[model samples]
Target: MTHEHAFSLHVPDLVFGRGALAEVGEHARALGLTRVLLVTDRTLRPLAPVTRVETALRDAGIEVILHDFVAIEPTESAIDRAGAAGQIHGIDGFISVGGGSSIDTAKGANLLVSRGGRIADFLPPPLGAGRTLGGGPLLPHIACPTTFGTAAETTGIVAFALDHGRGKTTLTGAPLRPSLGLLDPTALLTLPPMVLAANAFDLLSHAIESETARPFESRPAPADPARRPVTQGANPFASLGCREAIRLVAGALGPALDDPTDIESREQLMRAGLLAGTVFGMSGNHLPHALSYPISTLAHRWTAPDYPDDHPFLPHGLSVALAAPAVFRHLERRLPDRFAPVARALATDSVADALIALMRRAGLPNGLTAIGLSDEHHPALVEGALAQRRLIDNAPLTPTAADLAAILADARRYWS
Candidate 1:
């Protein structure tokens, strides 16, 4: 019955500003990268962000190999392909430019190239081989984010959809984090309104979930101190970042969405994403993020604007947003004290109501029904969410199958 008495925090070296991306070559050289794999998506390959990084690397005399086929919501096969490219090119380092997909793809590629295994070999059990990392040194990676959410640059987590309905799972460890992160706000200029809005919600949810996650003192002591999980639940270190992230999202998301040219807002949102990601890296997210995995996996008819339309897709933020109001309402009732600070940050009496209002302003879909789920989907949704035990267990109160079903049921429709 012993509880954990210690916690740890980890963050990659960070450079944040308007033109921070231009320094990629200098940083890559500092990391001693001679040949680097430049990971990005086809959508971003022609963009200024990718081009700028490529030019910077070449200018600094680093050999660059381009892998621009990263999927918008990275798939296991796609990541494997990226890893194969790195192996073939004998890349000594990685530079990921784009959103979470590109960064996560690079992480998977680094793991495979360094460890000589498939992505699943490093995942948790019942889904993969559950192998632990740290066997040897992984190639250095510098993550340059184009979007304002997911914060893949600062985290040690890599999430991707498993092939053939296996659903989504994650690989997490200290070795998976990027060697450094470049948060350049200029990359957000081309973001579509809906994409911007979705990113904002994701940042918002990360802060809230981390702020209210189970306390570190509530977790059982790890049998091996060295094997302490990346997500150790809430602690004082995480709370500091969470508070600022919530405030930034509240004040800046709308302005950033309304005017893509607003560099100030864009900078704020990027900073918020970094803070929230850093917090969640320590505390982890709970029900909303867990629910999002299934919601994203099961989405068949939903396609977001300004995203790749090659397949039916749901942005990660919208899926999280669909269930956030209901989940926070449950939390407010159960832990009013913890909920109070969040409400104050959002400047609302009800955190749930505030989220709904923000979602509407951001042009997010109303609920699960709007994204093609219904009462019949609840069972599968519950099963899918429960599989994300890593995130679900982080909640202050763990939800049962029945509880998850009820939450999905309540999430069916946010407003008429």
Candidate 2:
């Protein structure tokens, strides 16, 4: 394998345990926080983890202002509200206490409120004004993840979908990543089985995509240094993390999702998530993730189990899988010998087979139709997926418009 001799990695103070939520206060206080903006979502308002975090912060004499307005795929307006809450309250520290959506909301809000800018200004070029975030350090925030997907907690990038996410804008930089990520298995207890399974699929997919990411040497380096992305490519450090993440997800995700109270399984998935987040945070994903953007943005249908009625749509992980079964099957055929490790790590006869089985058992949508898309949606969906050239460029193989359409068309039906 082609690899770099010298590369750098940014790692946060990651704390993982069966009950890591209890340390949120001490971590905040250690940062010399007197007041903090506690960011979460409405769904988690009644959960035990939120209560524990509040008590810990308040008990430590830290004043807490709750910003629970976060929703899935938060819009610029939603995040701005969170930024306002943080800046207006005169809070010195920040904490995100839920899934990728909540933590990512805190990341975005913290960026604008502390550094000062509309969300568009910090996004990558052609999508936003392309501003840099390197003047100085921003606020210190702790990420307490309640879900196992999204790896946003360990990444230097925050992805927000606006304009119905026709194109997702990103806020990227080392400072945008959290200072600490707390993994408490207890927080995951409230997640329903299907919820756990869906996110775990995300974790598994992230690792697989990372492992197959195009090598950095193949691409021309960005002329503008600031435009350099966190998803650089497959590298030594990232591969190690992705490999382990795939193994952990394959082994433990089934049990954890099947039984939410299985702390041992939950702990393993958490570890896998952390590894997946770290790997994809830097290495990035390709086809499945690239297609997921349009799937999420263009989604007009409603589903409820984890998401509320007003906020209707499939979750990110589930959406990522709509085209995944076909995408991976195509990938294996195109790059037949390139993914031996992935095939083995998943511990299945076929990479796609294992993925299909997991999704099948989890009640995850096996097709675009299942998630509320039809033949009429295909042309628009393909156009949107193609627009994400940044991600598509990272794919193991370059796909034509026809190829992409075929994948979507194949995804429109059952997993077969």
Using Cα atoms with residue i matched to residue i, what is each candidate's TM-score against the true structure? 0.98, 0.94
Best of the candidates, TM-score = 1
92: Cα error in model 2, Å: 1.2
Report per-prediction Cα RMSD to one decimal: 1.1, 2.5
User: Which residue pairs in model 1 clash with each other?
Assistant: none
Per-structure clash totals for the candidates: 0, 0
lDDT of 1 by residue, 1-416 (tens): 88899998888999989899999999999999999999999889998999999999999999999999898888999999999999999989999999999999999999999998889887766778888787466899999999988989989999898998777878888899999999999999978898888888888999999999999999899998877889999888898899889999999988888887998998888989988998799899999999998999888789988788888889888888998998999879889998898998899999999999998888788889998898989899999999888888899898999888888878888888
Supply candidate 2's per-residue lDDT for 267: 81
Q: Per-residue lDDT tens digits of candidate 2, residues 1-416? A: 43333334666789988778998888899999899999999889889999999999998899999989998766777787898888889888789999888888898888888888777777766767878787576799999999888777898777777754455555667888888999987788888876787788888888888888887666566665555556687777788888888888888877876675888888888888988887787777888888888887767665746667685776788888777788988889888676778888888768888888877877777688877788888888788888878788989898888998888877876656
